[model samples]
Target: MNKFEIFTNELLKWNKTHKLTNYNEDEIKKQIEDSLYPLEKIKDSKTAIDIGTGAGFPGLILAIAMPNTKWYLVEPLKKRYSFLNYIKTILNLKNVEVIRDRVEKANLPKVDLITSRAVMKTNDILKIIKPFLKKDSTILLYKGSNVLDELQDIDASIISRGNRNYLFIKGEKWAK
Candidate 1:
Protein backbone atom coordinates (compact mmCIF):
# COMPACT_ATOMS: atom_id res chain seq x y z
CA MET A 1 0.00 0.00 0.00
CA ASN A 2 1.03 3.58 -0.55
CA LYS A 3 2.10 5.77 2.37
CA PHE A 4 -1.13 7.74 2.29
CA GLU A 5 -3.23 4.59 2.43
CA ILE A 6 -1.22 3.25 5.33
CA PHE A 7 -1.43 6.57 7.13
CA THR A 8 -5.19 6.80 6.60
CA ASN A 9 -5.73 3.25 7.77
CA GLU A 10 -3.78 3.84 10.93
CA LEU A 11 -5.35 7.22 11.57
CA LEU A 12 -8.85 5.83 10.95
CA LYS A 13 -8.23 3.14 13.50
CA TRP A 14 -7.45 5.85 16.05
CA ASN A 15 -10.18 8.25 14.88
CA LYS A 16 -12.93 5.67 15.39
CA THR A 17 -12.75 6.64 19.04
CA HIS A 18 -10.35 9.61 19.44
CA LYS A 19 -11.57 12.24 16.91
CA LEU A 20 -7.96 12.73 15.86
CA THR A 21 -8.46 14.79 12.71
CA ASN A 22 -11.34 15.87 10.52
CA TYR A 23 -9.30 16.21 7.36
CA ASN A 24 -10.43 14.30 4.30
CA GLU A 25 -8.07 12.67 1.80
CA ASP A 26 -7.17 15.88 -0.01
CA GLU A 27 -6.81 17.76 3.22
CA ILE A 28 -4.70 15.01 4.68
CA LYS A 29 -2.50 15.18 1.60
CA LYS A 30 -2.10 18.89 2.13
CA GLN A 31 -1.27 18.47 5.79
CA ILE A 32 1.32 15.81 5.08
CA GLU A 33 2.91 17.96 2.39
CA ASP A 34 2.97 21.01 4.63
CA SER A 35 4.46 19.01 7.48
CA LEU A 36 7.42 18.03 5.32
CA TYR A 37 8.33 21.50 4.12
CA PRO A 38 10.53 22.10 7.16
CA LEU A 39 12.68 19.08 6.49
CA GLU A 40 15.26 21.25 4.82
CA LYS A 41 15.69 23.35 7.94
CA ILE A 42 15.78 20.42 10.35
CA LYS A 43 17.64 17.99 8.13
CA ASP A 44 20.76 17.85 10.27
CA SER A 45 18.85 17.73 13.50
CA LYS A 46 19.58 14.79 15.72
CA THR A 47 16.44 15.22 17.73
CA ALA A 48 13.12 17.05 17.41
CA ILE A 49 10.44 17.90 19.93
CA ASP A 50 6.79 18.00 18.88
CA ILE A 51 4.66 19.93 21.33
CA GLY A 52 0.90 19.41 21.67
CA THR A 53 0.95 16.56 19.22
CA GLY A 54 -2.72 15.65 19.18
CA ALA A 55 -3.00 12.53 17.05
CA GLY A 56 0.46 13.33 15.68
CA PHE A 57 -0.04 15.49 12.63
CA PRO A 58 3.47 16.66 11.74
CA GLY A 59 5.18 14.70 14.47
CA LEU A 60 4.26 11.19 13.50
CA ILE A 61 4.46 12.01 9.82
CA LEU A 62 7.91 13.49 10.29
CA ALA A 63 9.01 10.56 12.45
CA ILE A 64 7.94 8.14 9.75
CA ALA A 65 9.61 10.10 7.00
CA MET A 66 12.85 10.70 8.85
CA PRO A 67 13.69 7.45 10.54
CA ASN A 68 17.18 8.55 11.35
CA THR A 69 16.06 11.42 13.56
CA LYS A 70 14.66 11.03 17.05
CA TRP A 71 11.15 12.46 17.59
CA TYR A 72 9.53 13.32 20.88
CA LEU A 73 5.73 13.76 20.85
CA VAL A 74 4.65 15.82 23.84
CA GLU A 75 0.92 15.76 24.58
CA PRO A 76 -0.95 16.45 27.77
CA LEU A 77 -3.97 14.18 27.35
CA LYS A 78 -3.63 10.68 28.70
CA LYS A 79 -5.97 9.02 26.22
CA ARG A 80 -4.34 10.78 23.29
CA TYR A 81 -0.90 9.73 24.45
CA SER A 82 -2.14 6.18 24.84
CA PHE A 83 -3.45 6.23 21.30
CA LEU A 84 -0.17 7.69 20.10
CA ASN A 85 1.75 4.90 21.78
CA TYR A 86 -0.58 2.36 20.22
CA ILE A 87 0.05 3.82 16.79
CA LYS A 88 3.80 3.73 17.33
CA THR A 89 3.70 0.10 18.30
CA ILE A 90 1.40 -0.80 15.43
CA LEU A 91 3.60 0.96 12.94
CA ASN A 92 6.84 -0.37 14.45
CA LEU A 93 8.24 3.13 14.56
CA LYS A 94 11.37 3.02 16.68
CA ASN A 95 12.54 6.60 16.49
CA VAL A 96 9.36 8.13 17.89
CA GLU A 97 8.76 8.64 21.62
CA VAL A 98 5.39 9.74 23.02
CA ILE A 99 5.54 11.83 26.18
CA ARG A 100 2.27 11.99 28.11
CA ASP A 101 2.61 15.46 29.56
CA ARG A 102 2.14 19.11 28.80
CA VAL A 103 4.91 21.13 27.22
CA GLU A 104 5.34 23.05 30.44
CA LYS A 105 5.70 19.93 32.56
CA ALA A 106 7.68 17.71 30.26
CA ASN A 107 11.43 17.43 30.88
CA LEU A 108 12.47 18.23 27.37
CA PRO A 109 16.05 17.69 26.29
CA LYS A 110 17.57 20.31 24.01
CA VAL A 111 16.54 19.74 20.42
CA ASP A 112 17.50 21.22 17.10
CA LEU A 113 13.95 21.25 15.76
CA ILE A 114 10.66 22.00 17.48
CA THR A 115 7.36 21.65 15.65
CA SER A 116 3.67 21.79 16.38
CA ARG A 117 0.26 21.86 14.63
CA ALA A 118 -2.91 23.54 15.85
CA VAL A 119 -1.32 23.75 19.27
CA MET A 120 -1.84 27.35 20.19
CA LYS A 121 -1.69 30.90 18.92
CA THR A 122 1.61 31.84 17.28
CA ASN A 123 2.70 34.12 20.10
CA ASP A 124 1.57 31.71 22.79
CA ILE A 125 3.44 28.80 21.23
CA LEU A 126 6.69 30.71 21.32
CA LYS A 127 6.25 31.02 25.04
CA ILE A 128 5.21 27.40 25.44
CA ILE A 129 8.29 26.06 23.69
CA LYS A 130 10.79 28.57 24.96
CA PRO A 131 12.27 26.17 27.45
CA PHE A 132 12.97 23.27 25.12
CA LEU A 133 14.39 25.13 22.17
CA LYS A 134 18.15 25.33 21.78
CA LYS A 135 20.04 28.43 20.69
CA ASP A 136 19.87 27.71 16.98
CA SER A 137 16.72 25.60 16.94
CA THR A 138 14.12 26.09 14.21
CA ILE A 139 10.43 25.94 14.99
CA LEU A 140 8.03 24.83 12.30
CA LEU A 141 4.47 25.64 13.22
CA TYR A 142 1.77 24.43 10.83
CA LYS A 143 -1.10 26.84 10.72
CA GLY A 144 -4.01 27.75 8.46
CA SER A 145 -4.26 30.90 6.34
CA ASN A 146 -5.02 32.97 9.41
CA VAL A 147 -1.36 32.85 10.44
CA LEU A 148 -0.17 35.52 8.01
CA ASP A 149 -1.98 38.28 9.84
CA GLU A 150 -1.05 36.76 13.18
CA LEU A 151 2.64 36.99 12.31
CA GLN A 152 2.61 40.75 11.95
CA ASP A 153 2.91 41.60 15.63
CA ILE A 154 5.05 38.64 16.61
CA ASP A 155 8.73 39.22 17.46
CA ALA A 156 10.14 36.62 15.17
CA SER A 157 11.07 35.96 11.56
CA ILE A 158 8.29 34.03 9.80
CA ILE A 159 7.77 32.49 6.40
CA SER A 160 4.29 31.71 5.12
CA ARG A 161 3.45 29.38 2.28
CA GLY A 162 -0.17 28.63 1.53
CA ASN A 163 -1.61 27.59 4.92
CA ARG A 164 1.71 26.68 6.52
CA ASN A 165 3.94 28.93 8.56
CA TYR A 166 7.55 28.34 9.60
CA LEU A 167 8.72 30.38 12.55
CA PHE A 168 12.39 31.20 12.88
CA ILE A 169 12.09 32.41 16.43
CA LYS A 170 15.27 31.00 17.90
CA GLY A 171 15.97 30.66 21.58
CA GLU A 172 16.82 33.91 23.36
CA LYS A 173 20.48 33.02 23.47
CA TRP A 174 20.80 32.93 19.69
CA ALA A 175 21.47 36.02 17.66
CA LYS A 176 18.91 36.17 14.84
Candidate 2:
Protein backbone atom coordinates (compact mmCIF):
# COMPACT_ATOMS: atom_id res chain seq x y z
CA MET A 1 0.00 0.00 0.00
CA ASN A 2 1.09 3.55 -0.71
CA LYS A 3 1.40 6.19 1.98
CA PHE A 4 -2.07 7.57 1.22
CA GLU A 5 -3.51 4.06 1.13
CA ILE A 6 -2.11 3.34 4.57
CA PHE A 7 -3.39 6.67 5.76
CA THR A 8 -6.85 5.94 4.34
CA ASN A 9 -6.99 2.54 6.02
CA GLU A 10 -6.05 4.11 9.29
CA LEU A 11 -8.64 6.81 8.75
CA LEU A 12 -11.23 4.16 7.93
CA LYS A 13 -10.55 2.51 11.28
CA TRP A 14 -11.21 5.82 12.97
CA ASN A 15 -14.13 6.62 10.71
CA LYS A 16 -16.03 3.61 11.99
CA THR A 17 -15.97 5.26 15.40
CA HIS A 18 -15.60 8.95 14.54
CA LYS A 19 -17.38 9.20 11.17
CA LEU A 20 -14.53 11.33 9.80
CA THR A 21 -14.63 10.97 6.02
CA ASN A 22 -17.36 9.61 3.79
CA TYR A 23 -14.99 8.32 1.13
CA ASN A 24 -14.22 4.63 0.76
CA GLU A 25 -10.82 3.26 -0.20
CA ASP A 26 -11.07 3.97 -3.92
CA GLU A 27 -12.66 7.36 -3.44
CA ILE A 28 -10.06 8.28 -0.83
CA LYS A 29 -7.19 7.32 -3.10
CA LYS A 30 -8.68 9.25 -6.00
CA GLN A 31 -9.08 12.31 -3.83
CA ILE A 32 -5.50 12.07 -2.60
CA GLU A 33 -4.14 11.68 -6.10
CA ASP A 34 -6.33 14.48 -7.40
CA SER A 35 -5.13 16.71 -4.58
CA LEU A 36 -1.44 15.96 -4.96
CA TYR A 37 -1.04 15.49 -8.70
CA PRO A 38 -1.58 19.08 -9.86
CA LEU A 39 1.41 20.88 -8.35
CA GLU A 40 3.18 22.05 -11.46
CA LYS A 41 1.49 25.45 -11.42
CA ILE A 42 1.99 26.14 -7.74
CA LYS A 43 4.87 23.81 -6.93
CA ASP A 44 7.25 26.61 -6.02
CA SER A 45 5.01 28.07 -3.35
CA LYS A 46 6.78 28.86 -0.10
CA THR A 47 3.92 28.13 2.26
CA ALA A 48 0.43 26.69 1.98
CA ILE A 49 -2.70 26.18 4.05
CA ASP A 50 -5.43 23.58 3.76
CA ILE A 51 -8.66 24.75 5.35
CA GLY A 52 -11.02 22.25 6.90
CA THR A 53 -8.58 19.46 6.39
CA GLY A 54 -11.08 16.81 7.45
CA ALA A 55 -9.09 13.66 6.79
CA GLY A 56 -6.08 15.55 5.37
CA PHE A 57 -7.14 15.02 1.78
CA PRO A 58 -5.18 17.68 -0.08
CA GLY A 59 -3.33 19.12 2.88
CA LEU A 60 -1.49 16.10 4.20
CA ILE A 61 -0.93 14.82 0.68
CA LEU A 62 0.51 18.16 -0.31
CA ALA A 63 2.79 18.13 2.71
CA ILE A 64 4.01 14.70 1.76
CA ALA A 65 4.67 15.68 -1.84
CA MET A 66 6.32 18.99 -1.02
CA PRO A 67 8.25 18.18 2.08
CA ASN A 68 10.36 21.32 1.83
CA THR A 69 7.43 23.70 2.02
CA LYS A 70 5.74 24.84 5.20
CA TRP A 71 2.23 23.42 5.39
CA TYR A 72 -0.58 24.23 7.82
CA LEU A 73 -3.75 22.21 8.22
CA VAL A 74 -6.63 23.76 10.18
CA GLU A 75 -9.19 21.38 11.62
CA PRO A 76 -11.53 22.27 14.44
CA LEU A 77 -12.65 18.86 15.65
CA LYS A 78 -10.60 17.20 18.39
CA LYS A 79 -11.08 13.70 17.02
CA ARG A 80 -9.93 14.78 13.58
CA TYR A 81 -6.89 16.46 15.06
CA SER A 82 -6.02 13.24 16.85
CA PHE A 83 -6.09 11.33 13.57
CA LEU A 84 -4.04 14.03 11.85
CA ASN A 85 -1.44 13.98 14.58
CA TYR A 86 -1.20 10.24 14.29
CA ILE A 87 -0.63 10.47 10.54
CA LYS A 88 1.98 13.17 10.96
CA THR A 89 3.87 11.24 13.57
CA ILE A 90 3.75 8.00 11.62
CA LEU A 91 4.88 9.68 8.40
CA ASN A 92 7.57 11.68 10.22
CA LEU A 93 6.38 14.76 8.44
CA LYS A 94 8.36 17.73 9.70
CA ASN A 95 6.90 20.57 7.64
CA VAL A 96 3.27 19.91 8.52
CA GLU A 97 1.33 21.23 11.53
CA VAL A 98 -2.25 20.37 12.40
CA ILE A 99 -4.01 23.26 14.07
CA ARG A 100 -6.98 22.24 16.14
CA ASP A 101 -8.99 25.34 15.28
CA ARG A 102 -11.57 26.44 12.79
CA VAL A 103 -10.76 28.42 9.70
CA GLU A 104 -12.48 31.49 11.12
CA LYS A 105 -9.92 31.57 13.94
CA ALA A 106 -6.96 31.04 11.63
CA ASN A 107 -4.62 34.03 11.69
CA LEU A 108 -2.53 32.40 9.04
CA PRO A 109 0.79 33.83 7.97
CA LYS A 110 1.11 35.12 4.40
CA VAL A 111 1.24 32.09 2.18
CA ASP A 112 1.71 31.52 -1.52
CA LEU A 113 -1.19 29.15 -1.91
CA ILE A 114 -4.25 27.79 -0.09
CA THR A 115 -6.42 24.75 -0.81
CA SER A 116 -9.72 23.31 0.30
CA ARG A 117 -11.76 20.19 -0.37
CA ALA A 118 -15.45 19.77 0.47
CA VAL A 119 -15.10 22.79 2.75
CA MET A 120 -17.50 25.56 1.71
CA LYS A 121 -19.10 27.27 -1.23
CA THR A 122 -16.72 29.02 -3.60
CA ASN A 123 -17.96 32.54 -2.86
CA ASP A 124 -17.97 31.95 0.86
CA ILE A 125 -14.52 30.42 0.70
CA LEU A 126 -13.09 33.49 -1.05
CA LYS A 127 -14.52 35.79 1.60
CA ILE A 128 -13.44 33.55 4.44
CA ILE A 129 -9.78 33.38 3.41
CA LYS A 130 -9.44 36.98 2.27
CA PRO A 131 -8.17 38.24 5.61
CA PHE A 132 -5.63 35.47 6.03
CA LEU A 133 -4.23 35.62 2.50
CA LYS A 134 -1.22 37.35 1.03
CA LYS A 135 -2.01 39.68 -1.87
CA ASP A 136 -0.75 37.21 -4.45
CA SER A 137 -1.97 34.05 -2.81
CA THR A 138 -3.78 31.52 -5.00
CA ILE A 139 -6.79 29.45 -4.01
CA LEU A 140 -7.00 25.87 -5.20
CA LEU A 141 -10.39 24.33 -4.67
CA TYR A 142 -11.43 20.75 -5.36
CA LYS A 143 -15.03 20.26 -6.19
CA GLY A 144 -17.44 18.05 -8.06
CA SER A 145 -18.63 18.62 -11.64
CA ASN A 146 -21.22 21.16 -10.60
CA VAL A 147 -18.51 23.59 -9.47
CA LEU A 148 -19.02 25.53 -12.67
CA ASP A 149 -22.29 26.82 -11.25
CA GLU A 150 -20.40 28.07 -8.22
CA LEU A 151 -17.70 29.65 -10.37
CA GLN A 152 -20.20 31.45 -12.60
CA ASP A 153 -21.00 33.68 -9.63
CA ILE A 154 -17.42 34.23 -8.51
CA ASP A 155 -15.84 37.39 -10.00
CA ALA A 156 -12.32 35.98 -10.13
CA SER A 157 -10.80 34.42 -13.23
CA ILE A 158 -10.27 30.68 -12.97
CA ILE A 159 -7.92 28.23 -14.59
CA SER A 160 -9.31 24.72 -14.89
CA ARG A 161 -6.36 22.44 -14.38
CA GLY A 162 -6.99 18.74 -13.87
CA ASN A 163 -9.57 18.13 -11.16
CA ARG A 164 -8.85 21.45 -9.44
CA ASN A 165 -9.90 24.95 -10.38
CA TYR A 166 -7.21 27.50 -9.62
CA LEU A 167 -8.10 31.08 -8.96
CA PHE A 168 -5.55 33.87 -8.65
CA ILE A 169 -7.95 36.28 -7.08
CA LYS A 170 -5.61 39.25 -6.98
CA GLY A 171 -2.00 40.13 -7.49
CA GLU A 172 0.60 39.27 -4.90
CA LYS A 173 1.35 41.70 -2.09
CA TRP A 174 5.08 41.25 -2.13
CA ALA A 175 5.61 44.14 0.27
CA LYS A 176 2.34 44.34 2.15
TM-scores for the candidates: 0.84, 0.84
After the best TM-score superposition of candidate 2, give how far the Cα of residue 48 lies from its true spot, in angstroms. Answer: 0.6
When superposed on Cα atoms, how far off is each prediction in RMSD? Answer: 2.6, 2.9
Model 1 ranges off by over 4 Å = 2-4, 152-155, 172-176
Candidate 1 positional error at 176, Å = 15
Q: What value does the lDDT take at residue 152 in candidate 1?
A: 56
lDDT of 1 by residue, 103-137 (tens): 88899788888888888887787777777777778
* Best model number under TM-score: 1
Task: Tell me model 2's lDDT, rounded to 2 decimals.
Answer: 0.79
Candidate 2 TM-score over all chains jointly: 0.84
Tens digit per residue, CA lDDT, model 2, 1-176 = 76776788888888899988788888888877788766776788889889988888788988888888899999998988889999999888999989999887877786878888878887788767776678777777777656778866455566665656655454253214
Give the number of the best model, judged by lDDT: 2
